[model samples]
Target: MNGNVTAPLSWVFTLVFVGFYVVAYQHSIHLWRWPYPRYILVALSFGMVLWLLVKMRFHLPWVTYWIEMADYAFLATLMYGYFKIQDKDRRIKDRLFQSANWDALTHVQNYAAYDRAIGYHFSRSLIRHNNLTMAMFDIDHFKCVNDTYGHLAGDEVLKQVSSTVVDVLKAKDEQIVLYRTGGEEFNVIFPGYTVAQAQPLVQEFFDRVKALRIPYNDVELNVTISVGVSSLHRTDHNPLDFYKRVDSHLYRSKKMGRQQITLE
Candidate 1:
């Protein structure tokens, strides 16, 4: 009687342990990309199955076997439920992050994302002495467009201009990112590039915006942009200092002429 009870109990414990091991292995793979863990699990599972086969010669009662199987089924269901909940949680977090950081109208990074990225990059550049450039630009006569063509037209213009700029940056380099910082205003950050290196790209952006002909209703609308470019300065104390300097240069571009690039 003792041997009969012990045999079934041991099998039950082994199955429970295997169930836990499988759940842990799944979690580890989800968190990290590694192959060694998978191989190890396979080897262990094979060994466990062989050991179970050797123990299978014990003629256990049908009721005890059924009970052990039922226990394993319940445990497996719990593990699967937990894994699904974790996956769902991760997806929800990713979706929320995208909605928060991206502009709905232009489908680019929004001002909040700009604020976070600029600060992080600015600090990193100051520490590592890496090249960083910032460019601030806006539609030259954006208000006039909103007044004459209506807000919907203005929105379409913003969308098309942002798309054009994104395409230009993507062609030049993947590291360059554009942000919609304000109404009709956008900013670009060029990582690993100086003002001189970034100049031609900025000029290309200016020319492209100048050439854009957006159709709204029965009329076609033309747009021009004024840009100000600046690089990290030794005198800058914080990201705000860099931002102010670039903003002042943009003001200069607008003051000097409507459609041109200003750099310092």
Candidate 2:
């Protein structure tokens, strides 16, 4: 505490301490995220500055004054590096969530994400006495498309079908959860709507899908979809059972005929 900060040795010590803080702070990714390392770096950098001030007894010598620039540099570098790292981390997290939640082919929510969202909202709706409807949508004659136009055209049909469904149900209050649940099958969860309320919406969506004119190899393709709707009620059944009921309706729709809506 009694060391003379005006001494040349004090300037050397200040530089050494600042350099150490820079190394430890920048290389601390092994144990900490951005702000944590930034915090430590800042504290250490300030501590070095404080040591210089105290050594000089608060009167900075010419050499010590020049060396104070290192403090500013340290702060700027740490702040910049911190936010840079944080931004990278945030982008990575977003990519991971998208990969997990979104289907690769159709870019809608995958089944895993759909189940989680539906189950969560379904439970909350049951408790709050809100209305919710679930639908299982299947592309009718989809296998025939694959057989007739080849698998690439089939994939295009799937993508167009998904886009059509999304475009038709563009209401904000309609919390729509759509999933390509394997093969040519898709599932939709419509929260804040009853089975009856969702009927016309589902029909319109199916009609629009059937009306799509997708192009492949100089030929325009047509497709149709079958939808099954079921509502969730307080006293009705569990979530899985509710889903199963709609799934059965979906199968029945497919069995009876393509391009139809079956509600149960």
Candidate 3:
């Protein structure tokens, strides 16, 4: 606190401190957040400049005349290293988050994320006495597509089916979220809609899907889906009890006939 801030020796020590802080800051990945690391780097850079300006007014020893420029070069090198680490960390986190939330094939939320979201919304709906509806659907005779057209074609069909469902239902309510629960099966959750209110929209969505005849490699692959709808009841207590009721209707839809909607 009492050193010659204008002295070249003082500038040398200050720059070294900045360098050490940078090393520690960049490596402290789990500890620091945005702007904290950036602020430290900025303050050090500004101090280096102000100290250099003051040192210019004083005569330096011949041996240390070039030391000021060397300090600047060293600081620049450390900053470059910091930037490299920051960029790498951002990319790694992006990939990790995307893989966790999204399905690789359909680009919709995966089962793990879907489970968490539905459970949270289900609890909130019960507490507020709000309408909560679930619809589960599966492609009718999906195995036939894989057997007849090959697995690659089946994968394409699955992606397109999910895409169509999203485009159709997302506009009805932005809060409505859909997920591919597993192969050939998908689930949609409507937070504030009763089962009856969702019927016409879902019927239209299935009709559009039933009308779809995708062409792949000189083969026209036609597909249809069966949907089962259920609403949350006062008796429901947990996610499993809630989901099983919805799943039962899906089984009924498949049983009555393929390519139909069953809401009981």
Which candidate number has the best lDDT?
Answer: 1
Better of 2 and 3 by lDDT: 3
lDDT (tens digit, per residue) of candidate 3 on 1-264: 146677665666667667767765665565456645555565556555545544554655534645765676577667768977998999999999889888999899889888998999889998999998999999999998899889999998998888888988886778888888888889999888999888877887898888888889998888999999999998988988989998999998888886788896
Give the winner by TM-score: 1 or 3: 1
Order candidates by TM-score, high to low: 1, 3, 2
Q: In angstroms, how far off is 211's CA in candidate 1?
A: 1.7
Extract clashing residue pairs from model 1.
Answer: none
Q: Which stretches of candidate 2 lie over 4 Å from their true place?
A: 1-65, 172-174, 235-237
Q: What is the C-alpha RMSD of each candidate to the true structure, in Å?
A: 8.2, 8.7, 7.8
Better of 1 and 2 by TM-score: 1
Lowest lDDT 10-residue stretch of candidate 3:
54-63
Q: What is candidate 2's lDDT per residue for 1-264, written digit by digit as tens?
A: 357668766676677677776766666565456655566566566665655655465566767655665675677667777877897999999999999989999988888897788789878898899998988988888888999989999999989999888877766344676787778888888888888888888888888887789999989998888888998866766678888888889888888876788997
**Residue pairs in collision within model 3:** none
User: What is the TM-score of each predicted model, taking all chains together?
Assistant: 0.75, 0.73, 0.74
Best by TM-score: 1
